[model samples]
Target: MSLSEEPIAPTPTTQQDAPSGFEETESVNTSMQEFHQLYQKLLVITLVLTGIIFISVWIFYSLNTALNYLIGACTGVVYLKMLAKDVEQLGAEKNRLSKNRFALFVGLIVLATQWHDLHVLPIFLGFLTYKATLLVYTVQTAFISDS
Candidate 1:
């Protein structure tokens, strides 16, 4: 039989039997969605924890302290969001965004430090709350697998 006379193979008619690259892209999209969902869950958890802490402090201490803590926690959340955006960028844009983030962080720290009425510890702790979300995500990904 000549090459031109050879029979052509049938193409996949279903998604499951599609090309490996297509499946891989689908998996990547699925994982991206999962990551986003997990990130949102973690963000909510962090906010709730911060709110609880703030309320407790407000009841025991003064309103000013509680407000400061709340402010710090909110700022931390904002910073985390900004950092995520920066991370999503590539090359020069990423570097620029990263530098801007760092500068903003430093400025906030300085401003908070200069504010004599605001307690440093609470503000600092509040700012670090976002790290808890990252830690939770790390632990989850380490233990959990898509398979």
Candidate 2:
């Protein structure tokens, strides 16, 4: 048979072809994984720092004192604010609320574990209230903007 009568197999892609894993879906998934890693790092750091500060303050001052409680509560709130801002600055604005919500939930759990004997009920309750309020606000804003 003549050469032209034979079946031809497809040639492999040349170097100019993009890498196999460089497709759009893979790129998007990689971006999301990167963000997830960053968020986990931030959260771990935040929790460690919060625990250190809380224990140091408790060791130096009476947890039942109004002033000490005020300082601790405010410090926790400020830490939350800072965490939110840092996440936003890291280009996690789309996930800010969810991150904050999760962090707050964990913080409250940690607080319960560490301060269960210090009459810190008010602070825990207050922090939860604040977080819930923010959650409601975020949902409201999202809905309103969607409409």
Candidate 3:
């Protein structure tokens, strides 16, 4: 066929950069939502466990010790929330994870050390409650099947 007589095939449009399904962006949104939900669940678990443990500690140990633990637990909750926020913002607003979270730990330890009233062990253990919550979540997700 002659050049003028040949049928011209349509070219792909660059304007619509994404696929029709927008799977890439959609998956990101879905995963972010899942991460948010996971954060909420973990927060709830941490709070519930904190309350129970705080009460148990108060009953078994002493009110002062429990209060110390409470302080640490509160810090842990803040730290957890900050971590989630950083993770959510990762690669977007910020190129790397900020070291601000570590500052929270450092400040906690410093305060615990300086304050005669605050016992280092209890406060430190309380801060680790979040870690325990994470372990619980991992176990729940790994070992147990969704009902």
TM-score of each: 0.72, 0.39, 0.83
lDDT by residue (tens digit), candidate 3, 1-147: 788999997765663655756766788899999999999999999999999999999999999999999999999999999999999999779898998999999999999999889998899999999999999899899877764
Task: List residue ranges in candidate 1 displaced over 4 A.
Answer: 1-9, 14-17, 87-99, 134-147
- Which structure among the candidates has the greatest lDDT? 3
Instruction: Please state the error at residue 78 of candidate 2 in Å.
Output: 14
Q: How many residue pairs clash in each candidate?
A: 0, 0, 0
Ranking by lDDT: 3, 1, 2
- Each candidate's root-mean-square deviation in Å? 4.8, 11.3, 5.2
Off by over 4 Å in 2: 1-22, 65-147
**C-alpha lDDT score of every prediction, in listed order:** 0.78, 0.55, 0.92
Clashing residue pairs in candidate 3 (N, C-alpha, C atoms within 3 angstroms): none
Give me the runs in candidate 3 sitting further than 4 Å from their true place.
1-21
Residue-wise C-alpha lDDT for candidate 1, range 61-116, written one tens digit per residue: 88998888887788888887777667556453545554676676677678888978
Residue 122's C-alpha lDDT in candidate 3?
91
Candidate 1's TM-score reads 0.72
